[model samples]
Target: MSGAEVAGLIAAIAFLIIACAIALIAIRIGGVTREIKDTVAEVNKSLDAINAEVGPLTHEVEALLTKSNTLLNDVNGKVAAIDPVFTAIGELGESVSDLNTSTRNLASKVTNGAKESGKVAVAAKVSKKALSLLKKKPADQEAVTNGK
Candidate 1:
């Protein structure tokens, strides 16, 4: 064969090898794209499932919050209603303390008055005895002797 024809044949074989390498790279890239597409579809499906399940859970949470608020309000209202009773009890305690003080004062005055009255009674009796000793009569003695 001629040298020029041999050289042409070698060049054609090298071009074919380079084209096959490019084709192999394109095939690998296509395969990787398909895997990525599949993964994205699976993620979308999982997100849809989660969204479907979350709807009822959201409503239940809202309802629970509403009930909790109502219960809290009721407890607060009851506490407010009973507050006056505690205030009245405090006032009653103060009144009892005042009554005890007044009672103590009255008892002290009565004891002092009783002691003074006892002293007055003793002085009056002693004065009556002295007056009778000063008023004795001799005429009563003579009358009694004549009558006997």
Candidate 2:
């Protein structure tokens, strides 16, 4: 072949190889795109199934939360209602303590009074004995004088 024709032929073959490489790249890209589309579809299906299951669970959870709140409120109300009873009990305990203190004070006073009374009784007995002895001495003196 002539030089120019051979060079042209070589150029055409090079262009053809470049075109085939581009085609192969396009085919791989197409395959990747198809896999991506399939994955997206599966994800959408799973999302739909999750939504179907979670919708009722959401309502049930809300109901349970409301019920728990009501129960807590009832318990709080009962605690508030009995608060006065507890206060009264505390007051009663304080009153009983005061009564015990008063009783102790009274007992101490009574014990002191009894001790003073015992002292007075001893003093009276001593005075009575002294007076009786003086009366007997005067009678003895009078009898001796009569005998003389």
Candidate 3:
């Protein structure tokens, strides 16, 4: 074989090898892309499932919040309704306190009156003793003059 023909054959074989390598790389890239696409599809399915489960829960939470607000408003209204009763009770307590003070004053007056009554009793006894002494003094003076 001629040297020029042999060189041409070598070049053709080297080109075939390069082409095979490029084909293998392309195949590998295609396989990686397919795997990425499958993973993305699975992630989308999981997101759809999560959304399905959470949708009802979100609605339930909103309903519970609405009920709670209603209950709070009802409690506030009830508290407001009883405000007058509370005021009346406070007035009653004040009345009781006033009554207690009046009772204490009455007791003190009675105690003072009792002390004064005791003094009056002692004064009456002294007055009676003085009268008896005055009557005897006149009689004794008459007897003394008669004897002279």
- TM per candidate: 0.50, 0.63, 0.54
| Candidate achieving the largest TM-score | 2
lDDT of 2 by residue, 20-66 (tens): 99999999999999999999999999999999999999999999999
Choose 1 or 3, whichever is better by lDDT. Answer: 3
lDDT of 1 by residue, 1-148 (tens): 9999999999999999999999999999999999999999999999999999999999999999999999999999999999999999999999999999999999899778868789657767898976764564667556654774
Candidate 2 weakest ten by summed lDDT: 139-148
Ranking by lDDT: 2, 3, 1
Q: What is the C-alpha RMSD of each candidate to the true structure, in Å?
A: 15.4, 14.5, 15.5
Judge candidate 2 against the unseen true structure and give its global Cα lDDT, from 0 to 1.
0.92
Q: Give the runs in model 3 whose Cα sits over 4 Å from its true position.
A: 1-38, 119-148
Pick by lDDT: 1 or 2, better one? 2
Q: After superposition, how far is residue 62 of candidate 1 from its true place, in Å?
A: 1.7
Clash-forming residue pairs, model 1: none
Candidate 2 local lDDT, residue 43: 100
